[model samples]
Target: MSFIHLDRPDCPEAHRPEAHHPDRKLTARKLITRTGSSPPVHCGHVAMVTRVTKNMSAKAKQSNKSADKNANDRNDVASKESDAEKANPQWKLISHEQINTLLDLTVEQVQFQFEEILGLKNYQTCLKEASLLDYFVSGFWWTREMNYTCQQISFIMALLQFLLDNISEKQMPFVDNLNEFAKMISGTRQSPSPEVDSLFDAEQAMSITDYLKCSLFQNYQLYEFLFSQPREELLLGKKVRLPASLCPYVC
Candidate 1:
């Protein structure tokens, strides 16, 4: 029989003995109601909380990313500034140590390039010509970077003159040919004059020469000391003064 038919008072009820339990029926209804209500309300609250947390987390991540990008941009700017400073060297403002280091490195590179070009036939013939130009150009650039210091311009001129003279007056025949090498090939092969070619005024040349002399003296004190000493002491004319302590090891 169908459940509706059996539940009719007129028909014999199926499981009539169990139908009288009121507490169980009430408990079962309460459990069904709670189970249905719990899932939707609890699930909705949980979903809302999860979405809020996700939004906050995503916002924090975006903020961190932006901060990282800004930091990278700042670093890039700082690096560029440093590179510019290096490329445009401030010769006048640089410290002595920095100048010395720069000079050593540049001279080494120049020497290497000169040696490499020395073997080439045309370079061997005209190497001095190119080198003469190189020296003047390097000085020009140095002066340009130094805010066109008249003193520096003069120093370079005097220094070049001294180098030319010393190289021409050196020992050996090959060194003597350097004088010919310094000749102006472009303008009728005349002997090169550091003073004449230089743009510095006469007064400026004097100042530059004085400064260059001082600098050379400071750098080559040992050379000066050695060269100035007399080979023949003339022991008979001047008696040597004995040291306070009679040790032969006395300096």
Candidate 2:
């Protein structure tokens, strides 16, 4: 029977260490690799394999911990930014009806006092576009009779949206915000400091805006005069009678 050759091919005979001391009766069959060396030096020393493996494992764990720390830091920054935003918001969570109940008759509403008008733009989705257009055309302005096209309605609607959204306790956006509104409608600019996104990004807003720019934004002033409704003014008349002098005060 032929004997099986078990010597490693990489450990050549010339590189094999000769056994000089009798303490190590090493031969080619007894090959041991030296620690911390490449090319697998054939020697008679035990390699410190366990120590090297432990060091590499420790380095890997440290890298993992550093990555986790960086992730936590990013998450903390995001959370703080969100909290800051929550602490200071530009617009409050209030409805149009609630605002209407608190407002006084505005100068814009004065025109309505002299006409049988019904051209108020409602923010609620309950009113169909057809009905809204009908109100605009028939609200004593005779928009259809004056040859006002569909684009005119679009311009009127954009103005109403800007007015309603930017309205404050004792302020409205008329001539003061006219330029800003025009820029917004033409898709050229956004609100200066709004909490919301560009208005044209909303449903039907972009189409209407395009039509407004293409057709009827030129007659913005005339349309404002014809179909504008006055807001109700809030007035309180209180009469107080003082004692001992029969004096009365009205405020």
Highest lDDT scorer:
1
In model 1, the runs with Cα more than 4 Å from the true position are 1-38, 41-48, 51-68, 71-102, 105-122, 127-251
Stretches of candidate 2 above 4 Å error?
Answer: 1-26, 29-47, 90-251
Please tell me which predicted candidate would have the highest TM-score against the true structure: 1
Could you tell me how far off, in angstroms, the CA of residue 172 lies in candidate 2 after the best superposition? 14
Please give, for residues 36-83, the per-residue lDDT of candidate 1 as tens digits.
642234778889999999999999999999999999999977875564
Q: Give the TM-score of candidate 1.
A: 0.28
Please give me the total number of clashing residue pairs in predicted model 2: 8
